[model samples]
Target chain A: MMVSLRTKSSFLKIYSWLPILALYISVLNEFDLNYLNLEYFSFNFPFILIFFFTLKDFKHFDYFLVFIAGLFNDTVVGLPLGISSLSYLLICIAAAYIRNITIRPNPVKDWFYFLFIISLINSLNYTVLTLFFSFDLILMSYLVNVFFTFTFYIIFVSIFKYYMRGLND
Target chain B: MASSRDDFIIAIRSAFLKKSTKQKFSLLTLLSISIFVIVLSSLDLKVIKYLKVGINEIVYRSSFIVSIPENLIKNAFIQTTEYTTFFNRYKRNIIELENLKSNYVSNEIIQFENKELKELINNYALSSDKILAKIIVDHDSPFLKSIIINKGSKDKIKIGTNIYDQSYLVGRVIEVNYKTSRVLLLSDLNSNVPVTIAPQNIQAIVTGSGSDYGQIKYIQSGLSDALVDDSIVYTSGTGAIFKSGVPIGKLQSFIGGSINEYKVEFYSDFTQLKYVFAEVITKTEIIKPEEKVAENNDETNNPLNVKLKILEDELKIIEETNRKFQEENEILKNEINDLNFKVSNLNNQISSQKKTINQFDIDNQELDFLKLNLKHGHKCRRTFLNTDGFIVGTLEYKSCVLSKGANDG
Candidate 1:
């Protein structure tokens, strides 16, 4: 009986690390459904995962791991090595600032704030990639990506909340 | 107000500098590192390049392994769609195959002649071998169009090596690692192919529209008017970036608010590329026989041997020229014999035709006479009551009959 309880606890520990694991998988696999053939139909999954975990201050969501995931994202997407890392770190900082300011965080406010944060981060990303890296990115693509990432955040956050609830239980 | 201001500053500072127990670094530190890395990467350094290469090799392989399941799903979906349209595609392919087959012979002859002419002009020949590479990661990034292939410096794939999807230009390698390379697809916004628009022979640069098509740019103002829809766009080999005459896409005209736009629909779908060829070219200088001889012989050689060598070379040239002349003479002789045979055959035909014409003339005359004889022959015949006519078989009697029996009248 003791052995089974120990195994269950270990399993719970692994389960708690799922968000970061998903972030790594999403970056390496580039978890955008591009095969759907919808024009300008991509959303950054890592951004959503990073934003939620960092806001909640999940114990397993290491900043270094997120930074490394960003590097992997850049390599896979053929960007400069640290571009995604910078964007991801910025998202973390923004989430952290918001987390610190709010006493009783409202979900609706958080959702709208998430939109604003992604917009600013995406704009910064576009500026850095275009000005510094000399990349020729379409403004419309970045806009659409920001829109979709913001729109999908609430949906993903709800699911993440359920997982959080289960973890606490 | 002062306390509130302090709260805001405190929050901001905490967010930047605070590190939780489980986190190894603060967000500010990581952010600074990211910026430092970006600045370092932008500067050209050999150590940084090697480091980037090492990182790329590991990440590319890991990405490929991690992407396998997703790739399988994507492939399955694509296969399903292909099967749905298989019959129609097969029919279209059949028609295109037949047309291509008829053009294949002429194309081969043109390729051979082009090779010979290029060799004669360039003083060196480029022998290229294409190595097949499988795509390892094709994430189809929304911002950038690029793919990672499982070939790199180890396979002689260098930056700017032209990648092809069956002779159609796909893109060029932008980055190379030890065992992998990234190809910036021609559909990327940064990709600009110097191309010549066919049929009009207009030279222009095609920049990617950050989509599946490319846009024509940098053309002379009036040349845009000459670009019709479906005009072929091919690499002009201008600027020595790409090989000449490689087909890129076809032009598609779009009119938007009193302005005309031309887009190039690429021949090879960058999205569908599973494998591509990287052309590794090696140039060899042509060495003349004289140069070879000069290298082998010593300076101590007598003037006589040099004179003899020149004479031998001259003799060889003369003999070659003579041989070519003899072949030409043989061809001309054969042509002359053929013409003579034709002329003799025509003469025989003319004589036979003349004989036939004469026969026809004689028959017509005989018919005329017979018609006249119905009345005049009786009048001119040596009959019992026509003693004034001579015998019918006599020449004088024939003449009299020909006179329409005038003498008898």
Candidate 2:
């Protein structure tokens, strides 16, 4: 039952990917469940992956995963795509530092923090990206999507917990 | 040998951790490649255009493979929408029949008239090349109030085609893709039409300003005979975009006073355009001036000057007709007013005479009653006096036997 690399659960590995793949397909098909629309503020699905990677270990390799995931999300659904990679990497580093003091991987604590951190990072990214272009900021839609995604994370985490019943301590 | 074992252990741990240094390097390299792709997609609209063109080229090259599947999907969507629509209509018809069954006991005549009117309107819709297009979606956002029509460029629809329904003109086509077209309604900020008044024969341009109604401008002054209902507005065909004599709408009412330009309240119910048509006929001809100067004033003076002679005759006839109609309308209005006044005065006189006759009848009744009372009193007195005389005579007879000397005196 202990968290060890040797006896890593296959279910974790399989379920770990389902969210990222779902996000990718959803972006490609413009299929949003209306539960959580992180699209407006540009805190896309890959940011969730980056958050998980950062919390697993704050190594240089984790930073690289975060950047790659960010880059992929940016390419899939973003106006200026590379900006997301940079912003996401910066947020992941900051998140790792914050994780040292807090209950790092606790779903309730980590998900809410990730919501705020990702939103802030996206807002900064949007501001920097649209600095020259006269783009109108839709604050209400952005906030709605943020809240929806956070709620979805709560629900999805519960579902994940049920599915990982055998892995529970 | 120990260092090599340690290296192998490190590789295994990194692989398990999903963070081998080699994997990390590959991740960074992939991120750079993705960044490049993002930059390429964003900075250039040409990229999208090229991508579209590339897809189109592939589609064209492999049209035998592509078009069948594409058409099948399109047909499926169309057929499904049609089937659903038919089912809805069938349900509605059943409900209507049920209502008719219940209401037939009382309002059969009214229902029959309604049926007749619906038949007429359906006939009108069928008379032309009108397409019954369903409005799939209206851009609910205020910033974009365009409507998506069921028929699009794929249906041979083109831009600038005017849209209408049984009620009235709705809008014109602005943008057209293969399977989708955007219709900008009459209430959009950028819509205009040239309308002519049938009664006054005055022409004006109507402009839309995203309001409920459009504005009519540039009408001539002093057209006083133009009533709220008199204006029969139709397409002038001056713009050459819309055909002539298509019944756009009747003039509901006029807005501004005569000094400034006036806006007409069009009778066209634009909000409901479930079916409409774009007139395909071109009704306007371009006028050339070179043909005019050749038959100028010098030619007009000649006996066979067709232009002046026709103009003079038209002027004379128009003046006479105008004057005659003006006088007739004035006379009719005056007569109407006089009849109303006379009717009121006659009513007043009849009421007064009736009041006087009632007073006289009351006075005559009082006089007759006085005469009857006097007559009755006189008759009673007379009768009493006669009786008293009779009694006195009888007593005198008795007394006379006793005193004949007193009776002789």
Each prediction's DockQ against the real complex? 0.67, 0.09
Candidate 1 chain A vs. true chain A: TM-score? 0.97
> Native contacts recovered, in order, as a fraction for each?
0.81, 0.07
Candidate with the greatest lDDT versus the true structure: 1
Candidate 2, chain A: TM-score against the reference:
0.61
TM-score for chain B in model 1: 0.72
Tens digit of per-residue lDDT, candidate 1, span A24-53? 889999976678788989898898999998
lDDT string, candidate 2, B1-409, tens digits: 9996776665444333333452454333544555565566555576653553343233222322322443345446556766878977999999999998867643544444444444333322212356667654332222123455656666777787777765366667875555545577665445667777787777776665443456666666556346356467777868766655555555555445654334455555443333466533232332222234345645535445545644654565567556666776798899999999999999999999999999999899667545543543333222545553223234443333334333334
Query: Which candidate achieves the best TM-score against the true structure?
Result: 1
Interface RMSD of each: 0.9, 11.4
Where model 2 places Cα greater than 4 Å from the true spot, the runs are: A1-104, A128-133, A159-169, B1-47, B50-176, B181-285, B288-409
Per-residue alpha-carbon lDDT of candidate 1 for residues B162-197, written as tens digits (9 for 90 to 100):
999999999999999988999999999999999999
What is the Cα-based lDDT of residue B88 in candidate 1?
A: 100
